[model samples]
Target: MKQILQSLSSGITEIVEIPCPSVKSGHLLICTRSSLVSAGTERMLVEFAQANLLDKARQQPERVRLVLDKMRTDGVIPTLEAVQSKLDQPLPMGYANAGVVLDVGAGVEEFSVGDRIISNGSHAEVVCVPKNLCAKIPDPVTDEAAAFTVLGAIALQGIRLAQPTLGETFVVTGLGLIGLITVQLLQAQGCRVLGIDFDPKKLDLARKFGAQTVDLSRDEDPISAAASLSQGRGIDGVLITAATKSNEPVHQAAQMCRKRGRIVLVGVVGLELSRADFYEKELSFQVSCSYGPGRYDPAYEAEGQDYPLGFVRWTAQRNFEAVLDMLATGRLDVAPLISHRFPLEQAPAAYQLLNSSEPYLGIILEYPDPQQPNDLLNPTIQLEQEHTQTKAFPSESHTKAPIPHQPVLGFIGAGNYATRILIPAFKQTNATLKAVATTGGISGVYAGRKFGFGLATTDPDSLLNDPEINTLVIATRHDSHADYVCKALNAGKYVFVEKPLAIAPDQLDAIQSTYTSILNSGTSPLLMVGFNRRFAPQIQKIKALLANLKEAKAMIMTVNAGAIPPNHWTQDAAIGGGRIIGEACHFIDLLRFLADSPIVSVQTTSLGGVELREDKVSFTLSFADGSLGTVHYLANGHKSFPKERLEIFCAGRILQLDNFRKLKGYGFSGFNSMNLWRQDKGNTACAAAFINAIESGQAAPIPFEEFVEVTRVSFEIAEAARH
Candidate 1:
């Protein structure tokens, strides 16, 4: 469907034809009727995008420091490439949306098809939103007004934090869209509202909403006006809804508020506060999160888990419903708040208003009716102009073409790693990119177009059923790896899946059964796990150096895995199988490769008394050849340290590798050290090896036995650590 996308690298906004996203479990597919553009937030993003590199750095000093640290550790070129890739990602615009539900996904019982709803979905003809992020719109609310529900919830959330009461006087600093809405909501709570802004037009609107006005453009003194309005007493509370870098608004708000009164910040502003401004009054200050209680909670929003109404009172979705109810009862009128409207195709022109001097607020982008037939809503798009025919699922009797040894690639994911590393690596190997599929179609289309894929699709079955595709690359989430591998193998295709081939023992058993069946059919298609570290140049040198060793080797691998929030998807045991199985498996496979022997036994130990203790653990492996290796995966270390360090002690000699960039040997014949200008994690070499194996009909780059062995040991380590 047509969607508005902004380029952070070039600051360009355009309407692009994106494939309609497929509805996932607990999600609803909606056909948008209208969407509201957030002026303040989007304007800030556009300004940042338009600024020069130096200005951008100045705006985000923290990010600049991170970049400098990365350059120091990983070198300049790779750091710059990572930054460029991040900027190259297309950002979808608009969040406040009013739409009709086109379809309901599994487990979604709240809304049915044809239900009118409001959501924080982006500006697209079709949007797939989680049920918790969507609320049914009232019958009395029009689509245009319903588009303001999310914004109203933002305002109401701020008011909720302020805890305004009857006869209390409150000041809303910044009479923009949110500010005006906050003024109306506070007045609805029986509070006297005073609005402050530099714009006379906005102040007039605030006045129309029954709020006393203070126009900064007229050089009015807001503190004096508020003091007089409160009859020598300071105002009851103040809500700073202004977006600025100046600290004056907060200072003035502190002066205007009465003793022990509350101040809630619902917008961006400078935070350098004078100690006396808050110390004498013992005032309470809180920064309101967007929407409400469940704003950024993945379980609440993504997983459709709702907060108990009796305990939490109001959540982000509940706030949305409250705003819609107010709209139904005519308590919150948004008709006058809409300053402009534009069609979805003219979104670029609408964003232009943000940069222009033209006065605009609550700008709405309208979409085509769901009843209309729009070709843009197709689930698949042909990225290559010459690829005219789209192959459907072929029957078993379909004519089989002579299989060439060349690798024809179909990718199952277009995530950050796949787009920045895997796909580019395969592209350099001259692999024919057949198609790329993603649940959300944006990244698939982006990767397909950028890497010259013949087609981009939202369906994986399409890629698996295509006869021309000989190899399937699985870069999807950890939990989905085994399923994709089994399916690809059953389709008579070679498989190259990212690390940790299976998250569970049962999944490994299922994959083993599938592979055994495939082997019984007299064809052994290559099944390789993406243990790319073993392919690193330094690693290869270490492997060769260890090959001649007569004595047993002892290896130590220390990984500063870094801290990830407990709520991150990777930390979820069911999804990512914890860090040991998801990531530390790379070191397991690397050690296995260097030992050139099967892992016979494993032991694990983890930190105690922490929620995510498994992430900071040590695992030891005993190789059949008398080699022993210990992997210390610690997420508690500081970021400035080297991320990964590996040391080997064998035959009265020592070899060390640091962050895949440098290798040093001690007590060796002639080798002193080897270093590179940039870090190489063997991504390109890994892809090349896989492609070469396919072309030459050689064994899989890494044997399927080793893949299964490493994966099983990883699961064992994670289980032991958890216990």
Candidate 2:
């Protein structure tokens, strides 16, 4: 499928060929007919992308602070690389989409195939949108008109917050698409409206929608206009829908609003407020979220959970429906609002219009009709490289006949961790990069082209069934690890999965059973969990130092795992397996490796609170060799603090590793200190070990039994922490 992508590094907008996304459960696969380009929002994105690095840093001071912190801990080169990698990613554009349901995944009962709908899907020929983000279009509404539904929802949501009443006077401080829509919607509710904008064309459109106008380009004062239009009485409410850095709109909105009146911001503006403008009036100010209530909620949008109609009254999807109803009844007219249209292939020109001085409002991109099938509708496409630079090492081939054990690689995910760490690590090895797969398709294509992968696919099955690929790297979500592991094992291929082999006990049992069956059939391929910290240079030094120790050792691993949002996927128990299993397992495995003993017993202590925060807990592992280790995996720490610290005490000697970059020895001869210019968590070494094992037909780098033991111990620690 050819979809529009904008490069953040170069500010280049183009349509690129990528595999079409497959429909997942609770989602609808829509073949797009039209997608509206949000001028105000998209213009900001394009301008930001086009900005120089220093200007970009000036625009986003918070991200600049984060980069500086990363530099402090992870070193200069890695931090710079991280920032560059983030900028190199392609950003999908557009949200207001109109399409026909080409297919529906399981549990999606709201719309059927052939049903026309409006969604917040991006500018793509095919889009897989959650049911909560989609609403069926009425028969009377045209596809072009329905493409305005999501933007209309944004206006409606802002008005909903304003709580407009009959006979009320309202001022919309911007005559853009959303501003014009707000004008019409407020007029429909029997309210007198005043629209303000610098554009005369937009001001004329607002006047056509029965709104009194104040043209900013003419140096007209909106506050004075509101006073005159409302018969000397202050306006009942003000909706600031203008996009500017000047604080003038907000100050004007405050001055125009009546005492105890509402001011809802539905656009971006400087927020430097004059306290007296709002204090004396006791006015209410609220920044309206995009669309409505269920917009960014994972449960509502991703999991198909809807807000209760009676309690919430209006949700994002409900708002979409309301706007469509208004369009069907002619209460809301969008015909004059659309100023431009372009075919999907001409998306670059449309985006260029946003950056140009040419006036535009509600630019729509039209897609091919569903009846006319095209290659863009296909879920799979071959990625042909103009230059074939991918070379395979002449190592022995194992599973498939005539194919050497040269470790042909198929990566199942191209997420941040995979792209920044795992993929780069593997690219350094002797493995042949075969294909990369991702659910969304954009990142897969990006990673494929950037790393010289033979193919980019949305389907993992195709990669698994390929005869040439003999190794699978599962860097997908935690919930998918075990299933992919079993599948890869059954295919007689080596498996290297990221941490937390399984999220559930039953999943672990299934993986064990699958591996056992493979073992009994004499075709068991190696399975290795990504416990990379154990392979770190510092940790290896610690292991070598402890080799001759005879007494029991005491090891302490303090992880200043910084706080993420409670709603982050890693904190979700079902999806991310919580921090204990998702991340702290690395520490657990590292300690176990240094101790070189089985974890015979375990104990855990959590914070004393009503809400069980597994992220802030401590656990102790009693090893069979009498070596004891405690992992303090606490997220309640400052970001400026070093992230990870390890202290080991064995036989009158001590070793301390700080943030995987520096190590200090205490009371030890010939080894007082060791340090690195950059942080090294052994990611490269781990990848090399796995590849070398496959190439030489040797046992997995870290024993398979140890992988299972570490995973089981992590599960046990989680269970203990819960209580």
Instruction: Please give the CA lDDT of all the candidate structures.
Output: 0.89, 0.90
What TM-score goes with each of the models? 0.97, 0.97
Question: Lowest summed lDDT over 10 consecutive residues: which window, candidate 2?
Answer: 391-400
Mind giving the per-residue lDDT tens digits that candidate 2 earns over 1-723? 788998899999989999999889999998889999999888899999999999999999999998998889888989999999999989998898998998899999889998999999999888999999999999999999999999999999999999999999999998899999999999999999999999999999999899999888899888788999889889999998989999988898889988898999999999999999999999899999999999999999999999898899899999999999999999999999888889988888998899888888889898877556444556555565534665422233334453577788999999989999999999999888878889989999888877778778899998788778889999999999989999999988899999989988899999999988988888747989999998888888888888888889999999999888889898898999989999999988998898898999999988777364788899999999999999999888888788999999999999999999999999888999999999999999999999998888888989878878888999999988887
Report the poorest 10 consecutive residues by lDDT, candidate 1: 386-395
| C-alpha lDDT of candidate 1 relative to the true structure | 0.89
Cα deviation at 487, candidate 1, in Å, is 0.9
Give the poorly placed runs of model 2, Cα more than 4 Å off: 370-375, 384-402, 610-612
